[model samples]
Target: MKKYALLILFVFPISRTAWAQSPEVLAIRKYGTQNADKMMREFAAFLAIPNIARDTVNIKKNAAFIMSMMTERGIKNVQLLAPSTAGAPPAVYGEVKVPGATQTLIFYAHYDGQPVNPAQWAPGLEPFKPQLYTGTIDKSGKNIPFPTDGQYNPDWRIYARSASDDKAGVFTILSAYEALTKNGLVPTSNLKFFFEGEEEAGSPHLNQILEKHSALLQSDLWIICDGPVHQTGRKQIVFGVRGDAHMDLTVYGPKRPLHSGHYGNWAPNPALLLAKLLASMKDDEGRVTIKGFYDDVTPLTASEKKAMQEVPSVEAQMKRELGLSTVETTGAVLNEAISVPSLNINGMQSGNVGKMASNQIPTFATAVLDLRLVLGNDWQRQQQKVVDHIKAQGYHVIDHEPTDDERAQYGKLIKVIPGEDGYNAQRTPMDLPIAQRVIKAVQTTTTDPLVLQPTSGGSLPLYLFKKYLNANTMTVPIANHDNNQHAENENIRLGNLFDGLETMTAVMRMK
Candidate 1:
């Protein structure tokens, strides 16, 4: 529902064949150490800003702060790329041209974050206060004052919305550029920085922004610095991302709440109707039973399949960590499981629960559904499959509330309203030359072998880059696997943040 997919965080064993660090990585790490406090404090201050995309006033404040960050870093041609859609969140863009560079690379990340409910965060933490914790909050992490001295623990985390998904992306990439510039390490390729402000909002106006700025956004590759690294604590460089789509569902019952004492057994309950409908979509094994739900997925390439096998087996560990004896996918492992499409119930509502429970049947029931897509799946078509399945279930599916006459005529009625922000999946070939170069650059940043993933288990509108600019994209994630992204008490470990710096700088110094 809320991206319940968990990444494996078991510490990966380093082998004798560990990556050899380059001079650039050494320089970047040194620079990061010297400036770690300044970086965290700056990032913490930035995180203090409310960054919900729909909050125009506060969102603007975030943009201004990022622009200042760019200007201060000496990134030239800095500007906000606004879409034609008025009031839509604007993307922050800037670039640095290397004198003899022949190629351009866009370092992509988002500035906005998932909406938060302060009450949901654990005690001693606030979404915007940016508390420094000794470890994850739920594990008895301790809260301590932000240190003025440069001394700090790399394992310590800064908990805040977007701390990991992915204001840290902005902080990491920009800080890499700063480290390089400050240390006279000129980038080998012309570097462009683009930060979307509404990725968490599903990048609804991303198309408009790309349409308006296609010329300025051209790049040989877009190295997306989002999501998390391998669950095994191994550095990973993913070549693709899944797409995402969402919809809201409503099933009608009696015109008004009916007292269970009088109408219990006689009155139709919408909650049961909605529950049955959802159950009908998925089988006992958790596979969506909706016809054609998996029909359009593009099978992974042989190389991609091989890469997945090479990924550490975290299935058993993940299940244990999650306190589950079994997983939804009966036979497949975690990596194999997420490579396909998925149907998730993000949130469901009936009448009331716990203290609010009442002996009455609700007038209606509602649910928000999240549909994740792969390369061959079309967002619009995928949504239609569910709608079709509902019809197959004998529900009179409508897009809005049914009129009195229509309601009386149909025994089962439901409303299906899909969001307009849906987008398709995108993946770059794992063997492309640019992809190889990226893998090499990232590999230089750490001694642990780089995990080459076919697709991240999460979603992003990466396909739009190909649709608009014919650009290839890859992801090099930085957040700790258990950062609690898109949920309460989100965080980014200091080590991951600083490692991300070296990774970006390595790409900047790519040969």
Candidate 2:
């Protein structure tokens, strides 16, 4: 585990009121402003801890820290729910039960973040050492020294691993509880906190945890605090998330590297074969060419289609910001495209490039593929579709590497290795009574209407909650659109963090 610097102290006076704030919003605002310095210091301290799921030792430290945070805030029954497997990161669970409350809502977020490469970060920036910046890195934002006073610029951002992808979620949820209690306000619904420890690793063991503790995890609905807000800067409430799976496909050439000059024309280059195989998966129009790829996709409901039309269009601005003049014609716009499944090549490796270029042919080439599944599509069946397509290409597919006699017998040999077992897609009806209450609660804090998405392009293990607890789950994300989640330089805008506290407070007081 890596060591981090001690928390910094800021000195600033608290303001009593904010402009155009309602009475309910004012209570949260006053509490947030008065404790801005304390909250940020604690947040930075949490961010400083290393939280890679595979690092069992450091992961436990994160879980322990969260337990302490909950216990000190007067939350009851705070405990860690571990899986049957030893050394697995446990999910931190705690609840605030209101007297005579009929409805229960479980608030969810993940503590684990994607692994990072320190070299990829900008100068003077470290993944675990949280730092404040005047703005986003893409805008050439400069680093700002931690203020000695509590005063912070709302435009400033806190950069760290999991800053936006999720630690922000954990901080906002717990802090909202603290603010409401200290301000003499009580929640109308029984609230439960479920912080996952291994979401970035694809949540392979989540089902184990859920099955082992289904009785304690029951709730009317789960309000997820993850992902990002809409591109237009309005809050977003996503009803579903895409299911995910990964595949590693390798095609063989000669057993050993050979001289390009001698075997150039005589030998079939594995790199070229792999390239052709990948190209065959997609067409010039960017639509998948795999047979039955779209057969299992569920169509959108009438209300879902209406919501899609109501979403503000940001494709023109997005294309310009992404520096792309053309996009795949699979869907008319970005939202429409995510409604269907997708096949993407995450990465490919064959031989050396740049200064490492060689005049020899590599032994083999490999490509890692990602498949995104929508409702009605099964993960196993989706993977088999790709495998069946490979078989149709006249290649012998095997799970393991081929032996001498087997290699000699088969002219074209390839290997397909599937990742951990994946789950299928899940969606809750957008018009449920609980869903309406969530939308109404969040609307009280924002002037513009919220963007309700049928499914976000990202994937989560939300289906497990539905399977084990039989509860509906909805995502109310608060990170800025360009927070750079799952990448280096990830951050959360200070304004979003403040607004998120208010948003959660509103949800807690919902009728």
lDDT of each: 0.88, 0.88
Put down candidate 2 lDDT per residue, 32-134, tens digits, no spaces: 7678878999999999999999999999999999999999999999999999888888999999899999999999999999999999998888999999998
Residue-level lDDT tens digits of model 1 in 1-511: 1111100110111221343556777667667767766887899999999999989999999999999999999999999999999989999999999898999999999999999999999987899999998877778889999876665666778999999999999999999999999999899999999999999988889989998999999999998999998878888988888888998999998998999989999989999999999999988887889999999889999999999989988877788778999888778888887899999999999999999999999999999999989989999999999999999999998898889998889999999999888999999999999889888888777776778899988999999999999999999888889889999989988778877888888888888
- The window of 10 residues in a row where model 2 has the poorest summed lDDT is 1-10
Minimal lDDT window, size 10, model 1: 1-10
Question: Global lDDT for candidate 2?
Answer: 0.88
lDDT of 1: 0.88
lDDT of 2 at 61: 94
Off by over 4 Å in 2: 1-20
- The collision pairs in model 2 are 10-148, 11-148, 11-149, 11-150, 12-150
